[model samples]
Target: MIDIKNVNKFYGQGDSSFHVLHDINLSISEGEFVSIMGQSGSGKSTLINIIGFLDDEFKGEYFYYNHPIHEYTRTQFSKLRNQNVGFVFQNFKLINTLTVADNVGLPLLYAGEKRKAIKEQVKDVLEAVGLPDASEKKPTNLSGGQQQRVSIARAIVTNPQFLIADEPTGALDSKTSREIMTLFKELNQKNKTTIIMVTHDEKVALQSERIIQILDGRILSDKKVNA
Candidate 1:
């Protein structure tokens, strides 16, 4: 449901300009699981930011389900992002002060959903993420894996069109990472949730249906996994 054509990103201006992405051309269908693999400063993050509607200061065309994303105004872009995309981060990004249910319900709360509905939706997502009993607990009391699960629950609670997972497994142990990947796969397969994940680990990338490797601000390779 995403299409990007001839996209280029730059920082600074004039003679001091630094190009971050080089003629990026990519398309991702609905429900596809794709991973972006890159080292530090390879511009993978920039590309995903554009895809996720988090960055609009770039040159090129982006079409989301045939809607020209580049033509949206700031308010429209922000609304579109809120309505369509969910994000998971390496650091879990949870608030220690809030209950797990409260954390998971933030997006719905921001969207003006009622507390009763938000509570039900939060419960469903927590159950889906294997954290059915975590609603009353604080994030600080959870293990890293449990915290990540809470983050995933928060992301999916909105029933967003797609998910942007930036280094979701970067802070976990190998076994925990595997469990998280398994949860992601279940979401993709059962819920038809499209996922665009950025990761540096090859093993993590391999778990996705497709892998796109970036090097020096350009796409190095795009290939499907054997499985």
Candidate 2:
């Protein structure tokens, strides 16, 4: 569903510039669960941003579902992302002030969905994430795991075709992380959601069907995992 080639990303200009990603090439198929593993500053997050259409300052080619993503305008990217992508960050990016349902429905609201439809979608996603009773609660009132579940619920509420998770388990305990991974597995297996996750944890990466390791801004390895 995604293809990239010779991608290079840099910060700053001319002499003061620092390269963040270099000559990256990859292709991910539909219904595949892939993990990007790298140390801090190894360009894992940068790659994710590029894939999710969040970064457009780099030099390279990107094609999503045969659409040339590299040439999309800001508005085009926004529309495409809203329609096809969902994101989960290491830090639960939920608004502390919004109720769980509101947080989960933000994307649909921004897309101009009607109130009744948004509410139904939010309710379904909450139940899917095992958070049926969390709709009226603020994020601050939830535990770490519950908060992350809310984040996941928000990401999947739109039924996006692709899910991008960057260190999604970074903030939770091992048990909680395992629970989150189980949820991810169910999403991939049952929902056929294409998942591309960036994680430094090998154990977390192993849960994916494929692992891509990055080092010094380059892809070090890409291999399928044995079940």
Candidate 3:
């Protein structure tokens, strides 16, 4: 569902330039689960940001479902992300004062869905994430894993076609991380949601169907995992 070719990203002007991505070429099919793994400053997250249409200042051609992202306007990108993409960050990014249902309904509310529809969507996503009764709880009341689950619920409430997660399990313990990863796996398999995750953990990388290894702003390798 994504095609990127000869992509390069730089920060700063001529003499003060720092290149973050180098001639990156990537293609991901719909319903695929993939991981981008690298050390700090290795450009994994940068690449994801580009793919997610959050940053389009790089030099290259990006095609999402055959539409050229480089030609899309800022408002177009915003609408694309809202309609088709979901993002999960290492930080939950939830408002402390908002209830779980409210936090999950933010995207829908922004899309101008009616209150009754928003409430139903929130309930469905929360239940899908295995948090059926979490609608009324504040984020602070939940544990780290539960909060992350709520974050996941929030992301999928719109039923996005693509899910981009940046260090999604970074804040959780091993068991909790595994649980979260398994939840992602189920989402990919059952819902056919394409997932592109950025992570430093080999174990987490292994959970994906494809692993992309990056270093020094370039892709070192891209390979599939055995069942």
The candidate that achieves the highest lDDT relative to the unseen native structure: 1
All models: lDDT? 0.94, 0.93, 0.93
TM-score, every prediction: 0.97, 0.98, 0.97
**Ordered list by TM-score, greatest first:** 2, 3, 1
Residue 225 Cα positional deviation in candidate 2, in Å, after optimal superposition: 0.6
Error of 2 at 77 (Å): 1.3
Across 1-227, the per-residue lDDT of candidate 1 in tens digits comes to 99999999999999999999999999999999999999989999889999999999999999999999999888888788888999898999999999999999998988878888778889889999999999999999999999999999998988899999999999999999999999999999999999999999999999999999999999999999999
User: lDDT tens string, model 3, 114-137?
Assistant: 877788778888999999999999
Better structure of 1 and 3 per TM-score: 3
Cα lDDT tens digits for candidate 2, 1-227: 89998999999999999999999999999999999998999998999999998887889899898888898889988887788899999999999989999999998987879878788789989999999999999999999999999999988988898999999999999999999999999999999999999999999999999999999899999999999
Better of 1 and 2 by lDDT: 1
- The residue pairs that clash in candidate 1, if any, are none
How far off is residue 111 in model 2, in Å? Answer: 1.6
Q: Model 1 — which ten-residue stretch has the worst lDDT?
A: 110-119
